[model samples]
Target: MSRKPIIGKCRLCGEIKKLTFEHVPPETTFNNYSVRILSGEEVIKQVADPNNPPWDFSDTKGTIQQRGRGGYYLCGDCNSKTGQWYVPEYSKFVHIVHSALQEVKGKEFGALGIKMKGIKPLSIFKQIMTLFCDINEGMMGDNSLKDYLLNKTSTNFKRERYHLYMHIHSGSVERMNGIMVQFASGVGLITLSEISTYPVGFALYIDKPEAYNPEGVEITIFSQFNYDDEIELEIIIPKLESNIFFSGDYRTKEEIENAIQESKDN
Candidate 1:
């Protein structure tokens, strides 16, 4: 006999219902098919076998290069609502970003830069915000995010209060989809920050005017953006801390080079 469908509260509406697969970054962004996987244990053994000896894990560990996986996380109603209202604009935006990677005439940083046009900022913002919600609710198992979203509501969601940060990155076969939820207490208030990575990287968090910014990190500007304005995103090499790493992003310089070579072969 087939197992009974699990009853759960909707991430978008908070209504109890049967759950559905909710692709976190939306399915269209998963166009890249190049595959590459690696094992940390294998690398550790390889590095340790020569210098330290007896740290071998190659027998137990290996790399992973497989087709991307989708998240099965949502209720039927929310899945339908988001598909109707948000996915179209999000699909367009992802296409533009990926197209910039695939084709470019002559421009500085052509290989790793993008120039986007005819963007609907509100739509894209909502789409990205939705991704944050999906990760927080579906993956991280938090249900409180409906304050900013949910059907049949004109929420007093303050766009400016929440900040969006995008990190431009190149795709590799090893790239994955993931999120990191962090709580930081500073500036007199505890802030909940959610960072997500897949086709791109983004940080969704609260920021107040003239607040004590202890993080010292400069997030990108995305709220209240003009829908018709042209926007350009460029990639730059920077030193990063391991704690803040976006699991879905390119991990290392070697991984970056391998991804470039794989792209050329394809």
Candidate 2:
């Protein structure tokens, strides 16, 4: 049965309208499969149990989303416009990276200089920002994002308030976290959100401190490109493994296992 139309505040544009499912990452970018969406607390409970093995989510508690990982956070007009304007180009860029990852499947962890050809960097970046908007509602609600996304040619996003980072992701879990504040060892307190799925992951830092040093390559420069300016460029993106449920956790499988064993030993 088709679900009834949901009425709510649109994440983008902040208008009260009929909401539609806005995929965090576009559906074509490997987000169409069935996934069990778990809350951060649920994941922490599992991960906190020292007896529970890593990557074993068979008995985990979560709502099984048959369609994909997304929610009705956008209205029809905003959804249609962003989907038409940004998804295609973003999907192409994701596929290019996916193909590159496949070629170097068993290789060691290192940076890859991918020579992406004929890509609309602005559209790709806007699509990523769209994902950020979808994930966050009241916390990161800035009208600048709506204006930046709605106007295809506008390059006036508030760069001082936001920074976008990307990394190649290979993990067993997909994540979509709302705005969270956490303290890093050297970085003190930082505010950020993360969306990590297959082949790619993105972290959006909100009001980042000068001392905050984040993993992955920053791509906030993509906002400067014009709408139709297709260009060839190479980006050196590092591969990071997200084997656990923690946001921005990039411990490898071997590293995770070793840590688990050490915990038991101690």
Candidate 3:
């Protein structure tokens, strides 16, 4: 059977037109895998061995099968423009993350100082941030993001005091964690996140300037509008949050609520 093209409202422009699959993290990281798409939930996970935190997940076997087969939400124009404007920077960042992971195999993350050049921080930030919005709009059926993506642009991340924190992450059990997009609300702000579970794992935290920082974790606060030429980055292996969990063990809604509370208490 042949499938028909989807005619829909553009996620960015709101124009009624043909929509296309906007790979949440772009296709470079997902390798076009057919996977489960989850919105408003965590994909179940375990640490494998809590005692062995650095379990050399770099070589773990498995394919990330939960990237949600990409999301069909953007019109062709918005999709193409985003690709041209942001995907290249995204690919570069993904490559840097992969290299950083290989360098710290069997070792602790962070402590390794990384510096990148000729980069547009906002371009990359917008790319990741869009995935969160795309999921909210397409998967969760929300409209708040549509208006933001089109007009209400804010270039003053530092002035507005909003920051994006990032880290290198790999799935502890099998490293097949695909690009996972999640939304966490409460604690005085909203958190929109995207994580990749490949050996070169990544966590990008977008939160309000006043949101509570998780206890004991030191994050590098970065701004979108500031770094157009160079970006100073460090790769820390982030612990899985209640929102972004490993994929395997299922969590009941109640259990998930408990975990979120635990995170807040910390």
Candidate 4:
């Protein structure tokens, strides 16, 4: 059966055009495999029932996406522009991180400062923002991203209003969260969106508070680099786990199981 046409507003350009499947991390960067897409209720049930077979679709509310983990969120024009201008460099960045991780697997370390060269930071950052826009539903207030994304060489993202962070992520779960707000005890009110998959995770905090210090290496500096500029830097990315549904919850599976056991014992 043919998939029905999905017509809606373009997340980036805000144009009402025929939308196309926009890959959040690009299919070339390890997002090509089939995965189960679950709702919040489904996720809670799956977590509670550890023996539930994730591969079994008969008794579940989740849908298995065979093409890849993405949706028809962007119009063809915006998708083409972002793919041509930004995705190449961003894909290279992801592969580089994955290579580094493979080279140092099973080592005891909190973080790794991977030295990367010839990286187009602006393009990578723009690609990251495009993913953020795709996962979100509505256009940003004031349409700031419109100007920043539509222009291929534009680097005028609203730095004061948005901050981006990144970490090395590994776990069974792949998260593509829309914009959500939550209050952390010491972190104040955090209004953020995140995309956590293998190799890397990103969080964009909107109108972040001054006192809010979030986990992960701040990569807002990527916005400052020129689109074509290539530079070398060592990024210290701490490995984090996405075993839970929460945006910033990086607890490992062992930690989670121990906590659950303790709760049952108590």
Q: Give each prediction's root-mean-square deviation over alpha carbons.
A: 9.0, 2.0, 8.3, 2.8
Candidate 1 stretches with Cα past 4 Å from truth are: 1-4, 31-68, 104-114, 138-148, 151-155, 171-198, 207-266
TM-score of 4: 0.90
Expressed as tens digits, the lDDT of each residue in 171-214 for candidate 2 is: 67666787888888877888889998888999999899898878
For 1-266, candidate 1 gives per-residue lDDT tens digits of 99678788765676788987665567677733432333444444554443322222335345443443334456887788767766787788767756754554344351244446665555566677676666555523444446444532333446555655555443322223334343435545433444333445454555543454423123335434543444654433222211112342324545544655686699
What's model 1's lDDT at 30? 71
Candidates in order, TM-scores: namely 0.57, 0.92, 0.59, 0.90
Name the top TM-score candidate.
2
**Best lDDT among the predictions, by candidate number:** 2
List the candidate 2 regions with Cα displacement exceeding 4 Å: 257-266
What's the lDDT of the predicted structure labeled candidate 4?
A: 0.84
Q: Could you tell which candidate, 1 or 4, scores higher by lDDT?
A: 4
Instruction: Give the alpha carbon lDDT tens digit for every residue of 1-266 in model 3.
Output: 87799998776766789898777667786446665433222222223333323222333343455553466778888888778766788778777756765676788543445556666666676676566556444523434445444432444332233334444443333222333333335654344334444433333334443654532123333333543545555444443322224322224345655765686699
lDDT of the candidates, in the order given: 0.50, 0.86, 0.50, 0.84
After superposing candidate 4 on the true structure, give the runs of residues whose Cα lies further than 4 Å from its correct spot: 1-4, 47-61, 261-266
List, in order, the clash count of every candidate structure: 5, 0, 2, 0
